[model samples]
Target: MSTDLSLFGVVNAGSSSLKFAIYEAESCLLSGQVEGIGVRPGSKARDAAGQPIPAPDVTRQPPATPAEALLMLLPWLRDRLGGRTVSALGHRVVHGGPQHARPERVTPALLEQLTVFESLAPLHQPHNLAPIRAVLERMPQLPQVACFDTAFHRSMPEVAQAFALPYAMTERGLRRYGFHGLSYEYIAGRLPELAPDIAAGRVIVAHLGNGASLCALQGGRSVATTMGFSALEGLPMGTRCGELDPAVVLFLLERGMSPAEIQDLLYRRSGMLGLSGLSSDFRDLLASPEPRARFALEVFVYRVARSVGSLAAALGGLDGLVFTAGVGENAAPVRAAVCEACRWLGVELDSEANAVHGPRISRPGSRAAAYVLPTDENLMIARHTRALVAT
Candidate 1:
């Protein structure tokens, strides 16, 4: 097919940033992001080897919206391309409702329908669509695909997805819909080669980043996950308050807390930032000697351990655990603390291996294995796009 080309571009838009990657088939050619979108001084680019590529022009022109930021990023990317054609664009959308449980081509009708899902994922869905819309307007002829964050979890059994709510509400689509699907999917695909022994059994992948979640896989298929209904329902994130009691919302409402104010408090003011009042960055928290930082870390570890236990029950037993994402892959102390808490479940951490970022952190005698697997959601998205668009 003359239309087919090897190049594919992936865009992952979040509330505060836009990350884009260009891939020559499965290999990443280059990637970049404009963090602090509404804020300033956040444009950064890098080549395949992670070497910084300066973008002075992007720094000079500030983008007021995520859509504008991606549009601004186009020319610089094009210049870098020299003359290569991008076969298709792949986007990471957080919520897909039940109607879209797989990667779907982006259409005007689909985009309109996705808007109704925005209220379900207030902070992420809109931003996820911004770059897609920008690309649509700039390159109307370009083929694009949306790889949903909730799609992979659709494989979960009814028992795993069901809530205690009435049948009517549950049938109306108010049920657990796990996120970080792309990340978990990538891990599932790679787990067999990475850990052949544990790949065929019960395992958990902790995607701990600014936005975090735990996913349980039984033989490389999603059986359960920590996130439910929305991205805010799982583990404590960089700024989002996770797993809050339902009564708390009523109490706040009764006390005259405006919905907007409450949203701001949970989605922007909470997490390690709220607990420490110092910093949300795990590196900053670890470097600081402040008791507040220590307490915040303790809370995060406690929640992760608890979630691991819950997921283990879902699996009926545990064979291994794999940590991925920003914090999971890098923060040694965080991983150590969580693993120590899970000692009863058979995790013996090799402190030396962990400190140096070893893939296998568990001692051979440990019952449940532990490993650090770096996740590549962009690569996952590109794979899905290529499969769907057939380039």
Candidate 2:
């Protein structure tokens, strides 16, 4: 039932925010909108062009969930688009549980299978499915797709995906399932057009935002990544304590903390927000003079640099470095520190160009080139949605 109404939507359900984008076939016709819904409510909705729209009167209540947010979003989208028929809805499901390596149309059976992996990605998977469920209930006729963040990294070598635990645990899905695949996939897709030389070489793509990770891409495929098992395993993020010693979990448990409490602490109350005792926003930390905030920022940069080194090893060597997402694309100081740490690998930063963000920030004589490319996960999801629904 193909029609000119090739417009589709990509929903990225975050813990506090619900992002939705409308696309015209392949190209993104608009920017998208996000509604921040939670107990700590400060609600504002924006249209695709990023213009602020008056938010519906969603109250500051605990039950003000993502499903509620999605319900609110459908009308907003429909009003703005003048009732364009949504051909499909694509979701950025965080964990595909080793089995889903490609995008799939949402089904009751598929949703059930996806729910089983929620424990593996407690912070993201459950929320990811909320929109799918909402769409199923309210707009049952429209096709929906689930494009996994971990799916693209499925190409990583077996050695890169394993944990040092028991073989039984490995078989039970206890291994690296890298997040931020849609972001990296978008960057990889644009690399050939933006930087053809680096696109074909050993490259490391850093997706740094509120949630951060680095992926080593060889010829546009993931060879290694910093995130593993879950997004919580990567570099310290806005509120996530990444790569904590497993013993720390036992220690907390021994101190009488239940699994649920510990999970909340690690996934919600930790990372830069926990360390700084201030805001999770990097801009906040960067502007603060508090020692804790400085320390938190330093730790974030250190972890990113350290991960870059490890990923370079996985690639045998490094040809170029690409930074995207919010912090990677905007924060000058963070990029400077990371590139400085990677100087030994022949990354010579252009101080002026770095301050003024560029597609190429490395100096002419540098052995390894550096670039700043903004990521578009929505576009990637929309493309996948179109391809799957068309089939």
Count of backbone collisions within predicted model 2? 2
Give the lDDT of residue 165 in candidate 1: 94
TM-score of each: 0.96, 0.94
The residue-by-residue lDDT of candidate 1 on 293-380, one tens digit each, is: 9999999999999999999999999899999999999999999999999998999999999998779999888999999999999999
lDDT of 2 by residue, 1-391 (tens): 2324589888888777777777896666554444556665455656656777675455634337787777776765676677665778899999998899999999999999999988878888999998899889888888999999999999999999999999899998899989999999999989999988789999999999988999999999998898998889989999999998999999999999999999999889999999999989999999999999999999999999989999999998999999999999999999999999999988999999999998899999789999999998888999999999999
Highest TM-score against the true fold, candidate: 1
Off by over 4 Å in 1: 1-4
TM-score of model 2 relative to the true fold?
Answer: 0.94
How does candidate 1 score on lDDT? Answer: 0.89
For candidate 2, what's the RMSD?
A: 2.3
Worst 10 residues of 2 by lDDT: 54-63
Which residue window of length 10 is worst by lDDT in model 1? 1-10
